[model samples]
Target chain A: MKKLLVLSAFAAMLASGTALADTSGKKIAFSNNYAGNSWRQAMLDSYGIVTKKAVEDKIVAAADVFTTADKEVPTQAAQVQNLILQGYDAIVINAASPDALNGAIKQACDAGIVVVSFDGIVTEPCAYRVVVDFKDMGKQEVEQMAKFQPKGGNLLEIRGLAGTSIDDAIHAGILEGVAAHPEFKIVGSVTGDWDQTTAQKAVATILPSLPDVVGIVDQGGDGYGAAQAFAAANKPRPTIIMGNRQDELKWWKEQKEKDGYKTWSASIAPGVSTLAFWVAQQVLDGRKDIPHDLLVPYLAFTQDDFEAALPKIKEGGVATHEYTQEEAIAAIKANIK
Target chain B: MTAIAPGTLPKSSPRGNAARARLLRGLLPALSLALVLIAIAWLNPRAISYFGFNLMLNLAIPIALATIAQMFVIAGNELDLSIGTFVGFVGCVTATWLRDAPLLGIAVLLGSIGAYALLGALIHLRNLPSIVVTLGMSFVWQGLAILILPKPGGKAPDWLLAIMSFKPPYVPFPIMAALIIAAVVHFGLMRTSYGVILRGSGGNAAALRRAGWSLLKTKIVLFALTGLFGVLSGMALIGITTSADANIGNGYTLLSIAGVILGGGEFVGGRVSPIGAVIGALTLALAASPLLTFMHIPPDWQVAANGAILIIVLAARVLISRRER
Candidate 1:
């Protein structure tokens, strides 16, 4: 009876070995913070493309997906737990909140699941910290302001949400760059929190009091509202400004065409889809056994550079609307850090 | 609604009688303000000084504007979870566009009232319930904000920040602003035909409509005023924080609602009192201020506290109404 049982076990192993023996037979799990937003949805779509090819080509055993509805911290935290319970080798996480997600992240690592964060990073030395260096973006914006201002001008800096590590770190980087330039005096700043109407109201009231404002450093969409506010006041536009969205590029172009010139320069950061590919790959690789942290590099762009960056953006998967998964992932991995 | 009946000035009452009632009504809000002042003084002895008093006034100005903005919406049975978004967007827009143009920044801030009023009117005319619409609008605007300033770093107009942040002793700008808005609001909705119509529409739109009134117009105007006033509050807040960041007005939404409920404003809508709204806003500001200084509760509890206060205040109002009934 014992001999027969041993023989039967070997037979079962051989049967399963046909599929699992492939060098790329490792399975991966991708967990995202939110599917409701365009950025997150773009990432999830990229993951599907990348994972599908990997599985069909016999490179990956399987790929699972986990995503939340909003920037809900605990909900994303629980997603990590579900991935862990399923014995997933790795997970690409887009944490909704920093610091708040540490415990769950630590839990995923304890269970030997490789974790890689993209876009918004977890401050902890998790398996990998993948992000577009916000601080670097800040530095680039200040440096551009320096160029725009042969004689230092007043820079009214607008920030993202406060308290989040993203906002905190980016400001740190911007100040470091801006402080060195004595000519670029910071007039004042307030948290705009990324709303068009709210920012419009704020600009309307403040524009009356702060004349000679030359530069504006802020998020992309709200910049449109700020520009609108300035137009409403019948004031000439500011000379130096920084923004970071591709869609808003259209708005800038429209402004230029309609009004002869524009002041928007974007220090483009790779979106969340880049995160999806790497995180998916890390899981497929054997890196699942030990936790590792990684950071994705961000690129700065000028008026001349933006047109060049657009092609790369166009090549990136469902987000770009033009590239196949294999082609886009290969290009992104090859071109960027 | 019954609260209005008892407060009606008596036709037969002599001058002193009216004065005494006015004094009592006025004193309640004043007392609430004094208690908060006393608490601040007791907590930090140095906080009572000339500069300290000025500081409190400076602090009060932003919150007071916010409270009044919140009061109008609540009085008409609406909610604005968007003021937080409003403050953030308004502050950033002002900082980014008018950091150098002091005069223009002020104009932009005032002009936004029309902008907000129009936007507020659109929200009503679109034929949807306000709470959900405003909440969705907040998210959309917040997303728009990220798109605008994706990362943090912007400057506010100096004069704008100074105007919001600085206050001399014996003169409270936020109080003055709120009272002025309140008086205008009070008169607009009371002494004038328009005010009476607004009140009547708020209390019973069906009856108002049956009487050949445009309840729809009244609702839209009330909300527009509510938004305008709320944006007015955002103007002060834009100055106080003094930087443009996406999350600047994050917590103001719930805080605004709480101010209305705390000052004895009702939740079912249509009951507004300038004096009560002022007291409520002060009460909320005072409660929130104390928590920041003296407590070690969870950071998220601030939001919970606002919601809890609303419930408690509503319950108290219910019980009081029951006793009176």
Candidate 2:
């Protein structure tokens, strides 16, 4: 027993020595919810480049990445567990669901692994919530539409996964925007799971019923599908459709060549994977001063803005680390509430 | 159960053999869809408009196709869990690689179908139970889909998009194609020698082996047809969605099985119809529309309702079959 205790004591001492390694060099692991979509894939690719560049330039000592292409909660949670087991000082997460991921976040925080959530917000204090100002996002879409429809008109709000924080936040934002415009009558709303098919079909079905409906406040991917639905019906398209998907901007431009591209505009978006990285950095460096929440910058886009952003985004990749650690911290502090 | 050649029951008696086929062919499917529709109407009739009707039919296409694909394999006494992931993978790849080139888009689809068919056949030839292989293959296909697209964004042309959102006055193109496939598959299974041999193989593989026919060959053909349906469905959805997303075919896995049984087909094997699958698929779509309209039900509840409907329909079919026995 004494021999075993001595062995265990030696192991603990070694672990302590490694943890306090003076290089201020610690491994930061970026865990994701699958790089399955073009936007997600692009985001991950950008994360790779930015994390690598930052590490190479001595911004951080070492970096690691883990992904769950299945995008399931358990798989992503396992990735976090594995990162924790590997003794990463801090972990960044693009949680599939805030509630479902709470246990993992708690485990990491309890174990002294700082947890920062981006894109998807976890309600618990353990998370430093970094998200887009989705309410502003919703209000922006309406305001953009207000430019076209000076008189409030009938609207359809195509939503994402129901009951999810991301969808709810965005939906709440859209409603707040709608509150300002009493003239805008909400014709109908449906959950597309943020899928293109459901969005397209929902809009198409609703279109024949509501011919007077002038616009739709879409949740990202659904915007493109809604646009197609409008085109299919051979009706004069809506004056305003808000698309928050950046990767799709390129496709919108290509489509605009034949059809007038002015049919839709994007509010703003935070890169999920990029947010995960920044959150990891923040947690690892022990900057608890950051407020409970932060908003990733958003860029509302027009056809011309898409034309400009497409090359920069596609070439540089989404989440291309425009802000350095100091700049990112400042930005977070500036927006934190 | 019907594998025996009865003394008085006669060989391949339509009552003993064709009864299951007939139920799935016309009667059971039509009844289930009608009952579900009636229930939905009672729950909420406002969702029964022409637009809602179109939405239901459109929603059913992909699920129906996957169900029919599953039916082909299950009917042959095998299983293919990979078909869902296959559709997702092929759908994304076809949409991504040939988003602009319509001809190549179609060609890529055909090639994927061909590849899956060949792969299925190879798996069967290696003496592997398809369920195990297909389970692993589903993961592989899903992973590939992610690797290929990573994010759910891409541009499929507007012309293709038009077909999905616009259903004609006389007949919807999707429904028409579905009808044609149904008729072709139905007649091919009932009238052709190929059909008899394949159905017979499912009933008594050892007996068919004694008769000097290759069950392997027939099963391979079934796999091929299943792959073909997935390809067609993927292409159709590409038009509807106008963008290829990696998770486009999610929930299609279990939903396909639910559709098959609700369409009055059995899990054991033998007898499935493309028409029955369409009815089955549409039944599922309409099942939830009313809840969306009036019941203020969530999709999770609707999914539960679908499962319940499927169970009741399948149980009733089993009872009727037993009573006939």
lDDT string for model 2 (B75-127, tens) is 78777788778877766766677665667766867777777677667776897
Tens digits of per-residue lDDT, candidate 2, A1-337, equal 9999999999897556434434358677666665555556566666676778868866568666655435544335445654554567877777775654554566568768777777655555776777777777777777777876888788988988765666777788788888888888788887767667788888787777774778888767677677788889998767546454544565567667867656546543434456556656765655456676776766567656567666666532342334455566567667755
The DockQ scores of all candidates, in the order shown, are 0.02, 0.02
- lDDT per residue as tens, model 1, B184-259: 6567665887777776666766777899987567766766676566655655654654445565566667766766
In candidate 2, stretches whose alpha carbon ends up further than 4 angstroms from where it belongs are: A1-337, B1-26, B101-108, B170-177, B288-293, B298-307, B322-325
Stretches off by above 4 angstroms in model 1 are A1-23, A124-126, A195-198, A240-242, A255-264, A267-272, A287-291, A308-337, B1-325
Native contact fraction per model = 0.00, 0.00
Clashing pairs in 2: A35-B150, A36-B150, A36-B151, A37-B150, A37-B151, A37-B152, A38-B151, A38-B152, A39-B151, B75-B270
lDDT of each prediction vs. the true structure?
A: 0.59, 0.66
lDDT of 1 by residue, A1-337 (tens): 9999999999897556433534364657666655543344455555566567767876667776554433544335545554554556777766665444554566678867667776666655655765556777677677777776668778776776666666676788779877878778777675666555566677777777785778887643356567777889998888635354454454555656676554546532434454455445644443233234444454445565455544444322111322343443443445344
Which 10-residue window of candidate 2 chain B scores lowest in summed lDDT? B291-300
